[model samples]
Target: MCSLLLVYISVYFCILLFIEFLLPFPSQNRRHNQQINQKSSNFFFVFQISFMPKKMKSRYILLTLSIVIAIIAILASQTLFSTPPRVFIHNPFDILYGIKAISYSAITSVCSHHHHHHHRRKPSHSKKKISICGDFPKNIPPPDTDTTSYLCVDKNGCCNFTTVQSAVDAIGNFSERRNVIWINSGMYYEKVAIPKTKPNITLQGQGFETTSIAWNDTAYSANGTFYCASVQVFGSQFLAKNISFMNVAPIPKPGDVGAQAVAIRI
Candidate 1:
């Protein structure tokens, strides 16, 4: 009976040890699950704190840059389009007003220079008048006069040159004598320029209503106002008679603004 009691106590001690071990395993598994959940939460929190704020900051910077660029563009456009058109003076009387404001010595020098130039040009003036009207015995010749000159332009190829600009080009630069260009009655679509080097040129056309030079260019075009002229005369003692200059460029519409398109600039 003592041996039986000893076995019973041993079995009871073994069962108690097994129960304690099983309870500890369950608690350890619970703690491991809690640690894994904490690590996952920390990862998500770090992602939100680090990456989200950076993304937001980048967006804000881009938006700020876009606004600044838009503002600059608006201001620039306003400044450019709001500016007034430029005016140029071509009248001799208007130019004289500015010249008269100069010092006495400057005026004296200019007067002396002009007097010398006038004296030198006096003899040529009579020759020019004779060359122009000498052959026309009548005050006004017929519509088509037989009188000819150094250069003549006829759209139908009846004269030496087919175009007015070709006739002017034939005269070349620095002509001492009066070079006359006779243009027949026709609509000459051309851009004619007599450079400063070419002097003492006379352009005689048929009646003003009969002879015409037309071009399609505006100051707002690729070439500015100074260069957009249908006919530009820069030569000294240059003359144009019985010729109509016209700019065929479309006029500005209502509510639209642009620079002036000049028909002629002398």
Candidate 2:
């Protein structure tokens, strides 16, 4: 806007200067011609400056130039000062609080949407310990007997093991029977491996939204791309349901060496 205004002012001054050069002083024309021309138009009052003395014409030009320059200066100052300043946040607590607030809002929105659609899952009320735990499982217990096929894993110590890897290690090698591992809703932050010797393994979780296995291992840190996976399964007939595997490593920069991160390698 400031640029456009400046352009218009410049054009106006240019037109004024052109008109001053084109029109001759009234006194230089013959009396008869001046009288006839003046009588031909009633708009001569608007162009009366064309008949002004040299001193007055110079003063008019100076005044117009001064006004245009003043306008330009004011517009430049307004354009420079009108921008809003940027602010940087330095408080860790504020940052954390903001993050928590955002997460809470998102969860609330998801819950409200589910409620509106009548698709919200209810809590499990089954008596059997091996039954599927609903989304966001809490206080779920492990199987009382060792003969059961399912081994429960929870982060709250209510199950057989706190870590998923421990449950995988408990499986018998070369067993003909299948082992079903029931994982409750919680974050498991360790690397999990199902060796080739442990075949026919099945992993079940409460829900993908609540059950997650995450690690921050990159290829450079873990020594290789194969070892950087948060979960690795080499066993045959292995199946996983309602679970999430995440590699939380930062994205590698361009030309970065050995920065590949894998979430799951099967």
Candidate 3:
């Protein structure tokens, strides 16, 4: 509403400027300075008003009011509809723990490098040190014998399918049997969908931190909000555990059209 008002006001002032400065005016009397109407061939009438001292005060007042209103509208719109900043409060203990761990790692690395001068130190230790800061789970659990009709998906090609979408597509549609899909720990960057025809399906992941599915489709790009999800599930009796769905698209500002990006739609 405020935006429309601003645009209307802007266009009005532009027209006012054109009429005041751009239009030609032929003075009938120098002293009288009368207002006159000029008609063009297209039957369009233009009004020419003499610049009097009394009208100058009103014009100034109108200009000042328009400027003030525009500023107020801008500020009000920002205050009402602007997105709030995301705030993260970290635990002080976690900070101290991280600092201590880094310090210990540096000291141990220096000592190990100095003592093992004759021997060539392997680069594996550096990788291990890097893993200390990583929070994702590394271990992939073995599947239980509860569900015989099961498929496995792993990004490392150690399973039945390398992609989650492929595993879902391979499932028998409209199955009465409960099918389980075990996703190994790794990030899968793809959009997944389970149609209504495929029911009684359960998706199991190693852990939420390690097993994450991500896509970057927005509503505008996908044509609608219904099609923009990273994962869309329409199957009955569907279940997902230890899995994270993520839409890695950038955050849209207020007033952005078709900017809705969904993580999961069931």
Candidate 4:
């Protein structure tokens, strides 16, 4: 709009100059021509003074518009290209709420993972449909019972074997018939293992409170929970009755965490 107005003003000035040049000046009268030329020069001077304020005002308005356009362009570019600040929930009382939130999330994730691992390690409970122990021959005398099927273990050497594992070893790979080994009342500190080849074996004790098998292997002792068990049974149709299996590993100290040490594994 300003450019169009300037063009119009320039055209009007050119028309005025052309009309002044084309006017008749009475060329035969020299003194009259001089007076007419003096009047025309005075009229052009007054016209220039009267239009000076309007020309200055147009220039000032153009300058102001140019400055405003430049400021608007700069603001638009910043709005388009600048990055926005991240959004968050702020608590007036907790200045470190963001850090605390991150730490709490991490702790919760770790605890959930540990809980799943512990659940997987837990033993399952399933009822057996077939009884592993059937009825024994009642007519056989107590002292003259079949030696191949029945054995006894006593720490004082009053029975067939002195140790429980030695009695188990005596029945090597016997799977045709069920065998029973009775353990006397005593605290046996031993690691006992029943191999898969020796199936259908029963380990009997005098009583649960009187008989116990214990060991002290732990994860720190280079044995994991599965291997650190006091009693491990791998034989099928194997049964243990009236006995307590125990792992005597030390308890963890204050502010310390340790791996699991199992008492029994089957």
lDDT: which candidate is best?
2
Residue-pair clashes per candidate: 0, 0, 0, 0
Question: How many angstroms is residue 230 displaced in model 1 relative to the true structure, after the best TM-score fit?
Answer: 0.3
**Total clashes in model 2, counting residue pairs 3 or more apart in sequence or in different chains:** 0
What's the best-to-worst order under lDDT? 2, 3, 4, 1
**Candidate 1 Cα outliers beyond 4 Å, as residue runs:** 1-149
- Please give the distance, in angstroms, between residue 61's alpha carbon in candidate 1 and its true position after superposition: 99
- lDDT winner between 2 and 3, please give it: 2
Let me know the TM-score candidate 3 reaches against the reference structure. Answer: 0.46
Any idea what lDDT model 2 has?
A: 0.74
Query: Each model's TM-score, in the order given?
Result: 0.44, 0.45, 0.46, 0.44
- lDDT tens digits by residue: candidate 4, 1-266: 32233345555555654565466644455565465556567577445434334433454455455555445335423523222222122432242443466567778989999999999988767855653223323432144334437777767666668788998899968556778887877888888999989998888887889988888877666355568888889999988899888988888677554456778889
Residue pairs that clash (backbone atoms under 3 angstroms), model 3? none
- Give the per-residue lDDT of model 3 (tens digit) for 173-233: 7987788888888889999999999998888987899899999999999999999999999
Which 10-residue span in candidate 1 carries the lowest summed lDDT? 79-88
Model 3 alpha-carbon miss at residue 218, Å: 0.9
lDDT of 2 by residue, 218-244 (tens): 999999997999999999989899999
Superposed on all Cα atoms, model 1 deviates from the true structure by an RMSD in Å of: 35.2
Q: Candidate 2 clashing pairs?
A: none
lDDT of 1: 0.66
Q: Candidate 1 — which pairs collide?
A: none
